[model samples]
Target: MTDPNEVDFAHTDAADRKRREKATGLARYIWERDISGAELLDLPDAQLRKLAREAGVNPPSTRETWTVVAELLDEKSRWAAAHPGHPQATPTHSDEKIMWIKRPITPWT
Candidate 1:
């Protein structure tokens, strides 16, 4: 036998929780932050798992970690060794995404 007032309050509380969850470090935030599967580069397997946990992403196994790491490290190496005229290495496809990602708009948006 819940009162109408209590039910309304519970609904409001649930709505607030969802809003915060969506706005927090969700998958979209991780992607837009330029943190991709490519970030495992050069990091040890343990470190990679720890980093993934920190970033709210599920970690991969050693083999997968090495695969991603190799690609990223190769890119970094190529970029570092390239002459001034060489095309700059792109760490991630989304490297420039942060600037263009639309953030949570104000009520005006």
Candidate 2:
């Protein structure tokens, strides 16, 4: 059985393909910056809800990491298309600190 949410990019129209490419590019940018969906999971519920709103996606009742990532990607893709010249925000100092603290401490010092 096929998954309802699965995107068949191959057969999609040019506009759809471009949209997917933009979203994929957005994901790639985040990953390149060492930003993982796990960091988003650390966000408070209200923040997640706000992210969903900004992304133009209906916030899910359950705060699932993947769902949040998907919604964020969707919003970012649309936002990028709308503002091609705008600079993308990198992980802030606080964001990096949170990720660093969340990492497992190693015994080798």
Candidate 3:
């Protein structure tokens, strides 16, 4: 059996990968929904953190634009969950959407 005290670098690596996946997922969701980061900035810090948690990612204690986007998505998700009876409100925000697009989409182009 492996020593209990021995740290598992593999496990740590896996966890890091998971966190990155969650962060990426959160970013994609935000973009698809067209939620505004500025609106997320309007929410309280606790609420912002809540969004990160709901997204299965840990947000930094300090605020950031990506965190704000995650928070906005979480807020909308919570609202939808709370009001299942109500028709889902359009998530499209009037404010400009934050662009977090990854580079090198079309290498051949």
lDDT of 2 by residue, 5-88 (tens): 998764468745555554454444443334445565666787656544544555545543344455665565566568767665
- Give TM-scores for every candidate, taking all chains together and pairing residue i with residue i: 0.30, 0.32, 0.35
lDDT of candidate 2 at residue 87, scale 0 to 100: 60
Report the lDDT tens digits of candidate 1 across residue range 1-109: 8776565642476755644443233333344344433443534567646655755655543353345334544444555458545544333345654443335667965
The C-alpha RMSD in Å for every predicted model, in order, reads 18.0, 9.9, 12.0
TM-score of 1: 0.30
In candidate 2, the residue pairs with backbone N, CA or C atoms under 3 Å apart (3 or more residues apart, or in different chains) clash, namely none
Using TM-score as the measure, the top candidate is: 3
Candidates ranked by TM-score: 3, 2, 1
Instruction: Estimate the TM-score for candidate 2.
Output: 0.32
**Weakest ten-residue segment in model 1 by summed lDDT:** 22-31
Model 3 root-mean-square deviation: 12.0
lDDT of every model, 2 decimals: 0.46, 0.52, 0.56
How high a TM-score does candidate 3 get? 0.35
Off by over 4 Å in 1: 1-44, 83-109
